[model samples]
Target: MRKLIGCGLVVALAGMLACGVGTEDGPGLQLAFARQPLDAPCPELPGEPGSAPVLDAVELTLLRADGTVHFRKRVSPGSDGKVRVGGIAAGEDLTLEVRGLVSGQVAWYGSAAPVNIRQGVDTTVGIFLAAVGDVSCAARPLQAPRAFLAAAGLPGGRVLLAGGVDRLQADGCGPGCDAWQATAAVDMYDPATGIIYPVARLHTPRALASATLMPDGRVLVVGGVRQLGLQAGSGMFLQVAPGDVLASFEVYLPGPDVWIEKTMPQGMVLHSASLLPDGRVLLAGGGTAPDEEHASNFAYLYDPGLGSAGEVVKVTSAMATRRLGHAAVVTAAGKVLLIGGAIYPTAPPLEEFTPSAEGGVFLEKLSSGLPANLMFAGAAIIPLRPDEVFVAGGRVYDGQVLQPPVTGNSRLIRRISSDDAEWQEGPALASPRWLAGMVTAGRELVLAGGFGDEQLTPSREIEVFDPQGELAAAGQTSVERAGHAAVPLVGGQVLLAGGLGPQDVLRSAELFTPAALAGESEQ
Candidate 1:
């Protein structure tokens, strides 16, 4: 393969030739190139390639018998989806190499059959462009058994999975034998290489933490439980002592591969963080302790560029309600929407936070709330639009029930804007889910692996919702999970990692690739 530099096609002709038809002295060879049809299957390659990548440009190089470059030309496809290259020596055995560029990156490449260019004849080559990248699920995780971990998308199409429980000997620890312990292990997964390797470990072990990718490419990991305890009951081990909440947070700098620890105003768990428009992060409502009785009203602001060493500033503007297991998202209008969670009876189910002058912020309860007291619902920002969010299935609290009643089917809501905001109910989920993971994949919202049904069981089913269309079944994970981390990756893929599985915590992971969209033709 020949590598060429510069943005445009670099043309190098050994000698000047007339643009007219072939002559005895200098015969001109014309070559025409066209892409395969969109419905055509991608050609198999050694590595996975993107499916039906739109070819932005093409480069062709002619080589002599001895493998020396004789001529080269880069040309953009014409209206007919073909590129024509002329002025070549005829009646000679020449090797033709072609490369297809998608967004300036070499995505497809192939060599034409050795050709003996005959005088006064045009040669046509049909190049089939194959797709790149993996479109299949990953079989396992990089680390051991883990649950309630966090994942963030990095700049270079890599994913960072960090801090969760790593199960130890299941039966040796007595009644709590099945109980898993938290881990500080961190792993970096490169989709290009299909490798998940260890990075830096957190200063403290954490599970159920929130990892938000900042605009600067660093990840802010905040608030989770540190330890979990269980007791034997009714011939089965049950969680008797919940883990302690963690006030300390950490920052992971991908460039330096380092972890920096910082402290929040108070310990918290089951919280969520949103990346603000100004590059700072809003760490919102979570329980001050592990139990719902200790749910907190406190929220914090983390400025990555503030203080000589940076710091997490506690926001003095307390939320009207205490929230734990809530979901938060930054709207396009530069406002933060705090959604369903455990709140005091008097507290509203929905609220919005607006940043003010002098580095302060304020929260106002949205006039509209969930149809019911929903918590742990999956939330995501729809693509190609700002200030629009889609929130779905969550557990509904019934005062008399010790365990919140999980719904088998739940309503979905769309928030159009913060100013004069109205929560409009959309379609219902295909199945009821809570603690599910949601991410925007292209223009669609993908919900994966959450607790569902009245029994609050883990699920492996994946559902995709098209804003302009209806909710449709997509794919499934290898294992049923709840509280897992799902992150949208480049190239329209989603990475889902550790969460609580049917029988215990899960260390397994999977990747989901939605089917190709219509009108996606190869260039």
Candidate 2:
């Protein structure tokens, strides 16, 4: 009987060891996670006067039943909206404490509610901030001729930024039009320092113009109005030059400071221009006729290598509906996907443009059952996965001329070309806005500055959406803005160019990193 008891005890001990129970009876918590963004900072909304305190540093601790710590970590805000904590135990209760948070200047911070963990569970903690009075300089005024360094480039080659509006209004930048003027200055930003230096000035005044980075390394500056007024109808209209939409285009080469004029096969305005993988340039649909030309189905293809001798070829008129103020992006499949923009008054509007084998073909490719509500200035299209296109955050078409601008929780992320042939809502932004800049960086979708009709105010807030279509990370920009340009650079960073603010055209720019999305997970 004693021998049988001994054998049973040995078997039980073996079973416990296999189950990861140490003989010493130490804590059973095990830590594991995918990646951690240690340097990325999460942005906090600016505190109001005497409002509350803001937390600067967050510390996370894993504890046992006896209050003994298994692990601990410290985190801070990164340029991108991420605060990652990697290597968390697979199953352990965690307590988070926020310290060094600045409430005005006083280091007033708080702790978060305790979090319970389960095996293979991923979790997050929220830390609230208190506000105090702020005395530092507000966000700098964003101006024209804005430039950012390009990380990806050919060897021995340099990137340059030219032909944006100049700072004509210096009424102390930050929400509210003080002064506005056209810009003619050209500059270049060094990737090493993130600083822009004066290069040479251009003789042209181009505002709201489209600039394409050509394969030959020169920038192709296309049609933009050179005007001096705030009203939509009053400025000198460049689109109607010489009694027709301006057919004139120019290219700026760096060897020497020069702007060489080139003739467009067709004069057009507000069109979408992109560089094909073959080094050819495709200029598609815009207000092509003359003054106030709405949407045109016409498209033109330009080959720079063919030089002045080559004729600009006209592609087929294939759009089901005319469109403008829309976004056109080159998909990973080498096809151009034109997302939500204003459609003409014609029936069955809203279409997509894809390059056909013959030339270019614009066809209606969205699901009929999907929401066809008119989404104008607010729509942004980005790729979620290689085979999937994600469309999110835009105003719905009210079927009337946009007056007083559209507003609110209209947050919806639709998935295209997935297993489902339709759009499924993902997540919404903190606020509803129009004309905000959208781009994907580090497998995350970022929504930046835009205008909200309710406040009629521009926001510098920036938010990051996860790859899994989950909650958005907390972060914001130094300025609120929209109508600005957000382009992806090679090194996985984005260059936010000129956009209109409430008061003035933004002359300033900011860089965003993806550090705030950092986290730990259980295996």
Highest lDDT scorer:
1
Where model 1 places Cα greater than 4 Å from the true spot, the runs are: 1-135, 168-178, 229-243, 288-293, 384-387, 400-409, 412-420, 454-456, 517-519
Tens-digit lDDT track of model 1 for 377-464: 7777666545566667766543322244333434444544734455566566666676788888767888887876545478877888
lDDT of 2 by residue, 1-523 (tens): 1110000000000122334433422222221111111111211122122212123544445555455665565655434323444444444444433333333222322222244554334343333221111101111222243321111222122335555444554432223323344566655533222334566665555555566776666677665544322223111111233233446666776667567766666665567677677766677766622223455767777667666423357887655656555556565556665555445433343455556545767666554434434343433344355545455455443344433333333334344443233544545557666556667754666767766653446666666656565546346654555656665433234545545555655565445544422223211
User: lDDT of each model, Cα atoms only?
Assistant: 0.62, 0.46
Q: Which RMSD values do the candidates have, in order?
A: 12.1, 16.0
Clashes of each: 10, 38
What would you estimate as the lDDT of candidate 2? 0.46
- Checking candidate 1 for backbone clashes, the offending pairs are 48-133, 49-131, 49-132, 49-133, 50-131, 50-132, 50-133, 55-523, 332-387, 408-432
Best by TM-score: 1
